[model samples]
Target chain A: AQSVTQLDSQVPVFEEAPVELRCNYSSSVSVYLFWYVQYPNQGLQLLLKYLSGSTLVKGINGFEAEFNKSQTSFHLRKPSVHISDTAEYFCAVSPQGINSGYSTLTFGKGTMLLVSP
Target chain B: DAGITQSPRHKVTETGTPVTLRCHQTENHRYMYWYRQDPGHGLRLIHYSYGVKDTDKGEVSDGYSVSRSKTEDFLLTLESATSSQTSVYFCAISGRGIEQYFGPGTRLTVT
Candidate 1:
């Protein structure tokens, strides 16, 4: 079974400050990583994903994450955050599918990013 | 918003009553999933369907049941509502990959 762990429950940052949300996963088989962001009372939006080929994957809203295979970590990062960036972020992992049949995602508890002005 | 919609955006029902949440999608994606979100728990999958009439359980499947008779509709039923079941439910669709398009969500409360 694949499981994801997000170490931080909440991260408070000021506007124009850099931030990083940590995520780690445990999976014996090959897996894919993803970061999703959710605004207040809204559904999750895809931030970025690491399928293959690139260790550093950039996503919407100027966010990016690096997949470190040895460390089993895929941490989300931003050079600077805005007040609008305040939201809950989730990290998830799923096994690499064989021919279109893939397993469901295992998500972490999520990290709340609180950006202040 | 790739044509995914959830019915009864905000519902308040009494305990022991039956409640059904509907998810409708126009994208006709092959995969549909139901997940519940709560404070400190993030989002937990309850059920998913790879195709019509083919459903499977997820991490949090107890007290919840799902049915998918058509490609565009997936229904989640709570047999007997409980206070523990109060949470926001989200529906998602995907096309055989990690990227999933999510619905706006339905907030359900049991009092």
Candidate 2:
């Protein structure tokens, strides 16, 4: 079974400063990686995904993650953040390939990024 | 924005009562899923449907039951509402790939 671990439960950053939310996963087989963001009282939206291509993946709102196979980590980072970037971020892994018929993603406990002015 | 909607956007029920949450999608996607979100835990799958009349359990399915009688509707039922079950419920739809779309959640409060 695939599982995810988000190192920090909450990360507070000043506006215009850089931020990084750490995520690590454990899966026996090859897997797909994804980052999702959720606003207060809103559903989760896909930020970015890593299927098989470039290890450095860029996403909406400038969220980018690097897939380190050896480290089993996909950490989300942003050079600068705004007050509007305050939200909870999640990292997930889909261990089974697409041919499995349906997508089942194992999600990590979200890391709440608190952006302050 | 996957053309998915969940009924009873907010519901309050008493213990020992039965409650069913409805998830309807217009995309006619072959896969529909029900997940519950609580503080700290991002989201845990309760159940998922592959097709009409076909369903499977997920990581957290002990207290829930599901049914998919048609292609566009998936229902999740709680036989007896419990305090621990109070959380936000989200419905998601997917095709045959790693991309999945989510719907606005439904908040359920059990008293």
Candidate 3:
């Protein structure tokens, strides 16, 4: 079984400040990692995904995450954030392989990003 | 936006009553999923359909049933609505990939 853990339940930061949302996963096999964001009164939208290749994955809204296999972490980062970026971010993982058929995503509890002026 | 829409955007039903939520997509994606979002639980998959009449249970499939008679529509039903089932339900679509596009969501409250 695979699981995701978000270390922070909430992160508060001022506008234009750098921020990092920590995420760690437990999986024996190679997995695909993703970040999804949900604004107030809306559904989630994919922020970024790490399928293969580069360890540094850039996503929409100037957000990026690094996949560290040794640490089992895929933390989301932004050099600067805006008030509009205030949302709930989720980290999820799905096992990758031919044997893992019809695999579903396992998500962490979520981290609430609060951007203040 | 992947042209996904969930009907009955907001619904309130009493406990013990049957409730059904509809998800419709226009992108013709091969995969459709149903997920429920709670305050601290993030999102948990309830069911998914790979193709018409080909559905699978997800992590949290208890007390829930799903049907997909067409590629464009997937329906989720609660046999007997309960307070624990009150949450925001989202519909997502993917086309043979890991990335999924989500709909606006349906807010269902079982009172």
lDDT score, candidate 3, position B110: 90
Candidate achieving higher DockQ, 1 or 3:
1
**What is model 1's DockQ versus the real complex?**
0.63
Off by over 4 Å in 3: A99-103
lDDT of 3 by residue, A1-117 (tens): 899999999999999999999999999899999999999998888999998999999999999999999999999999999999999999999889832224478999999999999
Can you give the lDDT of residue B81 in candidate 1?
99
The clash tally of candidate 1 reads 0
**Tens digit of per-residue lDDT, candidate 3, span B32-103:** 999999888888999999889999999899999999999999999999999999999998888767678899
Q: What is the fnat of candidate 3?
A: 0.53
Error of 3 at A67 (Å): 0.6
TM-score per candidate, in order?
Answer: 0.97, 0.97, 0.97
Candidate 2, number of clashes: 0
Cα lDDT computed for each candidate against the true fold: 0.92, 0.92, 0.93
User: What is candidate 2's DockQ?
Assistant: 0.72
Per-residue lDDT tens digits for candidate 1, residues A3-112, read: 89999999999999999999999999999899999999999998999999989999999999999999999999999999999999999998886546344778899999
Q: What C-alpha lDDT, on a 0 to 100 scale, does residue A52 get in candidate 1? A: 96
The sequence of per-residue lDDT tens digits that candidate 2 reaches over residues A1-117 is 899999999999999999999999999999999999999999999999998879999999887999999999999999999999999999999975555447888999999999999
Q: Evaluate model 1: give its lDDT.
A: 0.92
